[model samples]
Target chain A: MGSDRSARYPDGGDTGTDRAPRDGGGRADTGVGRRGFLRAGVLAAAGLAFGRPLLGESAADVVRMVGARGPDDEMTDAVREVLKAKFGDRRIQTGHVQLDIPTDAPDGRAVPTILDIDLPITPNSYVATYHLLVDHNPDIYLAAYHLTAGSGEGPIETRIKMRRTGYVRAIAEMNTGELWSAAVKVFVGLNGCG
Target chain B: MPSMHHDSSRDAPTLTFTMPAGAPSSVGEAKILLPLSVARDAVIDVRALLVHPMDTGFFRDAEGNPIPAYFVNAVTVTYGGEQVARFEWTSGISRDPFVRFPLRASREAQVQVVWKDNKGGVYQQAVDVKFA
Candidate 1:
């Protein structure tokens, strides 16, 4: 669809608005669980496979149910599953890090996003692989990127499709007993994602 | 019969970010019909796209709780160990922010992209471009 974002893309960047601030973003050291999980909401491939959206949970909380674990722990569960499947239930913290995002998105379909890490990722002392996840997307595993000593300390710019407004998390497992995470919940307008 | 006026502006918009086949994920020849060349000192437009949902944290969950808004705040593109461009994301930006721009020339250069959210976590990707 034609959008102001499209016009801004050619060169203008994005529109300017003193968006109202919501909950804290990049709250890295906030507790471990119950809150402060990067898009901690998980999704159940089962629910998606069966078309059971959110399993009667709140739209925001629905994203928390990523892999059929419980209604409130979707995103966390899915991320844990991703880590477990890839890293064998490695040590991950619900509060190791936080995901950075805009507070007021004009639309949802193509909302820009960035995943950040508060810890160091080096050749011998850092996170080797990371997963960028969206809990409520039609597909939970939006894209996973592996990192090495090469990637600098910053963010990998990427975008994902949101079936609806939900949580997004970037789970990073270090070589040691350290797991870092970051999350940000996003809201989208109706018909935001096609 | 009475005429029914449809609110043209009320219609929901559509979004698509599918790139054509054979499109290179990094610098060099890519699909999408844009003429770009990758080389040392070869200024060429690099087509970079990431598929994202870009949740604003403003939408409601199944229970209707508010989904907080979130998006990338900054983006940096570096060529051959040198920073070429930096982008700042805005709320007005679309979900998937794709741009075709000139990559400053560099031999065996890597197009390194780093983006950060409002929090401190960062994500990075490096695309190597070796000019023939």
Candidate 2:
């Protein structure tokens, strides 16, 4: 299941990227999809207004255009920037959170990682949000898993793309407003930013 | 439409899947594996798989035209009508992704898994959470 194959999904539903669903059924009631659509539209408009090259020749070029931080700078700045923006002055203690990933990944397209939290998940106290950040990837905020008390205390296991050799950090936000974190370093031969 | 698969291993959990009513397209197939029987308050591992391309805009086709990003944006898990977990993803997720997590068996209810793509396509499946 963790194989590094380049197989793509069939083009059966690939024709609707540009068109917003006219009738989204339940989606129309929640309005969540509308928010996502609006955010994407705003970002696209900003890119156009600035007159900057929105498209890139390659994944690396795309990353460079998004943000141009030196490799050395990313070694520390990547995690720090996210921490400053998310946690701010909140203390992010380590150790309660743990991450399991391969030390050397031949293909950066899919590197499986498991997240385990040594905390309780009850109605009063639980991990509300789990953030996975890639220190060197084009998009540092790789994914976020929102959990509720009903989720039952369980380890989150999934695969992610890594652009290069860097730290993949997992930060958990508790319902009590506490933050916990853990990180793992991985080396990737072929970046999967694309 | 929904497809079902049975496990060969006796220890493997039984999986039940059902598509959401009036879903737009058969965007993809999704499967959720949970044990058929579990002790009260027992913590068990639940594995889920969704068939997706997870395309990044950087990729091009044979004609050298950009594929345009089309990926699963989020996956939500609900237990007996209450949300248990929601995973927000980007193009960074792998193709045909499999996500495994630990789930505590507290009662007999329905376990539903939904996958929402970037283009507002939603695919869902559910299983009965039976306790031993």
Candidate 3:
């Protein structure tokens, strides 16, 4: 679950650059104070131009900083939990599974996504199941698909609703005891979690 | 010709199956396309389109009343009477859901798909698989 905090406060400190003196120097009686104030002013200007929030930090800030860093942590944990419950402690590797989602989605309500397993579908070694998950949604598990000898070799395309900007993941389990996964970060302009 | 009947009432849930071209068919709002056969050790593609409002119950009406939640709860696919895949869905799933997946072609068997909605309605479809 990526947050706007790091992007807001790169240094992760409590110093309010906005409180700097107008002339970029606070009580220039001390040369060090003058330099510090000037630096603060410059940082404040950059933050404002970059659209970083200037308000006091909230609990969300602490949570965002302490919780899972990106979609990989949250999504991987969810997938691992499901797999562990179903197949035990099996190794899951990245690759072979392709997840397609727009980097920026104007409407989170109907973000079109596709999942394709690149491996050949053979009776001896084939993709048997797929799990789609979303980090930061009310329900992390979005949907699951099971493929059999009756299914074709085409990519699965569908529209999924996201609660907010987060990571989306796809995991495929092969019949030969191999699990492949893929994920993508999506920026949602309009929240659709509801 | 098999006629499709649309019924919104919760008491009667409709279920129908349609095979590829040249088979006895019933036209319904929902359709699942499955290949008739595939070469041995080949991959088989399965696709399905289901009809449902998938109302999230979050939106409000003109009078400001919230709509009740109604959507598909579960979908499962089976091959030769063996479980293949199962999906648990939420309101996040798109309206009139369309799903696709792949399977390893092995032998001649029957593929079955079943979906159950929140309103206690169960729908099912099936097709035969021929391996070359």
Candidate 4:
């Protein structure tokens, strides 16, 4: 549908900030809910070395954007750093809960795709939100589709951005308040519609 | 997903989409495969993959500041005068978004995908699948 960030998939691709702090357990400290994921505003203070529990008041103050460069550039680095600091020790299993993306986008804009939460989900264990990420996208945390009993019924769908070529990831947040993720790399052939 | 959405004017706007070669289909696998290319009327299978940035435009800028969020607002797909799928979602979308689904296979139907940006820009694609 698109060439640039919205090329392949109509909604674009994954791209989120890798800011915030790491948990003592050494796993990437991601917000399982509205609580802690990096808001696009936190990139400014991210280098200040804020403590764990990213969304808290002490970690940052919502910084107003001052320029045209989108935070998409820092996403992969920030996410990877935090993930290593927070989840370096866990052995993540590759399953339907996670999704991989292909490179060589025909369009950078919307890329069509589906993420299946194949993990058995019950009322107490259903996935709350499916976290989507892309390494080379503008940001590492592409998008987190928040869901509940009404939306979490199955594989969620949407379009995201892709600045260039990179890897895409899918993470599922369980009702128990834990995070699980899977990722795949992409080899882009050219800039989308650029 | 691609097609024509004609207004009262009668000449509908067309749609289009494209993807890189050999990109991975699923995350962690590191590679996407594409072999499902069937004829429009053959009733076969279809598989496709695409890259996405989906920036919320809410992140900070070079000076450590929050940038405005920018994202896609709509998506439409069609094959042979029939609407196959459509999506209207916000940013918060993941990277390298991979979509694998089934459809009533065809070749001449003309597959097109279109995305409308938050700022009112439109990006589209139209592919004539001739998998005879």
* DockQ of model 3 vs. true complex: 0.27
Candidate 2 deviant stretches above 4 angstroms: A1-74, A120-123, B1-27
Error in Å for residue B13 of model 3: 34
What RMSD does each model have against the real structure? Answer: 20.7, 21.8, 12.3, 19.8
lDDT of 4 at A12: 26
For each candidate, give its TM-score against the true structure.
Answer: 0.41, 0.67, 0.60, 0.37
Question: What TM-score does candidate 2 reach?
Answer: 0.67
Off by over 4 Å in 1: A1-88, A175-177, A191-193, B1-132
Per-model fnat list: 0.09, 0.73, 0.57, 0.13
Best by TM-score: 2
Steric collisions counted per model = 81, 0, 8, 109
DockQ of each: 0.07, 0.26, 0.27, 0.08
TM-score of chain B of each: 0.63, 0.76, 0.71, 0.58
Minimum summed lDDT over a 10-residue window in model 4 chain B is located at B1-10
Tens digits of per-residue lDDT for model 1, B2-105: 02323222454433344468644432221221234455554455566543334455456656566556555666666667665555554333454564444444
Which candidate achieves the best lDDT against the true structure? 2
Full-model lDDT for every candidate: 0.49, 0.70, 0.65, 0.47
CA error at residue A61 for candidate 2, angstroms: 39
Runs of candidate 4 with Cα error greater than 4 angstroms are A1-76, A82-100, A190-194, B1-132
| Predicted candidate 1 versus true structure: per-residue lDDT over A63-116, tens digit per residue | 443532232332334544555565564545555454566645555555566655
Model 3, range A5-71, lDDT digits (tens) per residue? 3344444343444544555554555455756776877777776553333245466754543342331
